[model samples]
Target: MTEIAPIAKPDRNRPEPLWHQAEQALRGLIADGTWTDGMQIPNEERLSTMLGVSRITIRHALRNIEDSGLLRREHGRGTFVRSSTVIAGVRGLTSFTQEMAGLGLIVGSRILERDEQAASAEVASALEIRQGEPVVRLRRLRMGNDAPIGVQTAYMPLARVPGFLALEPSASLYQTLSAHFGIAPREAREVYRVGTVAAEDAALLGIETGSPAFVVERITSDAIGPFEFVHSIMRGDRYEIRSRLHI
Candidate 1:
């Protein structure tokens, strides 16, 4: 579980309404994954204290957020963050961590496999590395709100990301790569297939065998060239891809 960040106090001096600033501060918590799915939030009074605002302002902000489908208010109960869909933009090159965080979902990973292995022909082709070259492989069971969402296996050239095996897979791989290895993906090509989940992936994702799934293969390139190849099997019921069309 991630630490929840404290809500920032709204500035009364700003031209924006106090309720609006309070609303944006609360929304910022949701957007950054601090206020996660299905989690009950502080009461209006508590929120008022935290944000240094009156209960009335907090109430107005909470009502606006609830009306927008970001929260649910139950009678005699507290407001809870809504369990939102795991959505990704079709045109974006985003890591699973960033994608989930944007939707206020805390992403968790159960490491299934982590080892150095010889690159398979397909992986080598995708990464533009020689076949049989050493590669670092990390396989993870991806989770949201403690529910299984997908199984992702990523491969990178061992030479490019040395000592990657030592880092915890719970953190974002792309962030680690950029911070430690100075490698960042600039472009990505993804191929999505609608298919039935295999027994292995189904077991990891807590779904029945032959359940519908989206099989995605992605080849990502840094400044030098292709460096990462990833395969993901996402539960069809839990994931969605959105893209805005250009007219």
Candidate 2:
């Protein structure tokens, strides 16, 4: 096992022990993506030195966190953070705006473009419309803390939502549909893949071109019919999807 690095002190006179403080500090770093998955942490001696604590204290802290499934120790290498991918399963009816807001992140959108376009073959097939049917294309970049978090492109049949583009883009599209058309998105079929952020997406997301990104394709519908197709690319570091499963 790699040695733990020195832990940082919490405050001048906090009641917590050096070890517990060290544990929390390390946990924050790992959870916030400051310490990436599979990356070895600094040795225990370094942790002790940095945290103003003894090696024993550092060891105890590391042991606790490791048992929590946040850290994994290799035979010869040091401890590393567990992977940080979020896995929002396709098994529920959840709104992205509500979900992200509940995480205490400010959800905002900047409309990149909105236009009426003839349905492409793929769009037509997904929307179950004729090839030359009109569709509303809305491209947007989502931000949290003024940092780009995800890029989303949504498509809807013009006939289904007559004046959707006229509505403020920053507002929740789903909510607007619900209020105006009584069309609640009851469920969605989502597909996931690993992809590179392209040049345009890189600029919009303020990341280097070709950086790793999570690509999600979603088709949402109500009991009446399918309503929207959304393609989103989320930043790998800033967001994680979570899910629960039962036997």
Candidate 3:
């Protein structure tokens, strides 16, 4: 276990709250690699004593840091520094496999369910298909470097891609679509929001229910028309979204 050095005492004359100062100090430790990933950090009592602050202040600081996705706290255990976030760029029309591969992480998928079903109202609207039309539904647990990172459910109109359900379980959906059907995603629009993990998805991602996560809803289209609708829940502690904009 790496011993965390005591933080400097926050000046009482400073306008910042003690808890805020403590949080910044801890963040600096993480940024400097003093606290590596998965290493247990000092407990609240020890931090309070070392920093000359109340235990309440230390607790508040730890909670804030944990919420910011830098720490994972376990009941009856201790807080551990989590891995750095995987940044997803908004400019790409890439699949999860492509994105993770670019970071040199091994990507794996476990198909939870796949079936041909009538499209629901939401799916139909997103794919620009008529309601009750046949669609191939795929639910998958997405893994990066052998660690579960997200759960994604995708719907595609059956008319657009026939025989999709016959593909191998572990094959990349995008690659299969491109190679067989010549359907490639040319553009995608995604909306991102924060939410607590639902029970089913939490189990699939191996996280506690109610853990913070990123909810991404995406609609993908080719030059012809919209064809795919996807909803994904990414682990907040392991992923972050990045976008570049030109002024």
Top candidate (TM-score): 1
lDDT string for model 3 (1-247, tens) is 5776667876778999999998888888876778877899888888888888999999899887775556887888888987444567654788888877665456888989999999989999999989999999999988865678898999999999898888776548888888888998899998999998999898888889999999999999998899899999999878976555899
Q: Which segments of candidate 1 are over 4 A away from where they belong?
A: 1-84
TM-score of each: 0.68, 0.65, 0.67
> lDDT by residue for model 2 over 1-247, one digit each (tens)?
3444444576648888878888889877775666766678887888877877899998999987765445667888777765432235433577667755543344677889899999998888777889989999999888753568889999899999998778765458788888877888877888889888999999998899999899998888888777898899988765555455579
* 124 Cα displacement, candidate 2 (Å): 1.1
Off by over 4 Å in 3: 1-84, 244-247
What does the lDDT read for residue 20 in candidate 1?
99
Q: lDDT of each prediction vs. the true structure?
A: 0.84, 0.76, 0.84
| lDDT (Cα, tens digit) per residue for candidate 1, span 169-189 | 546889989988999889999
**Candidate 1 global CA lDDT score:** 0.84
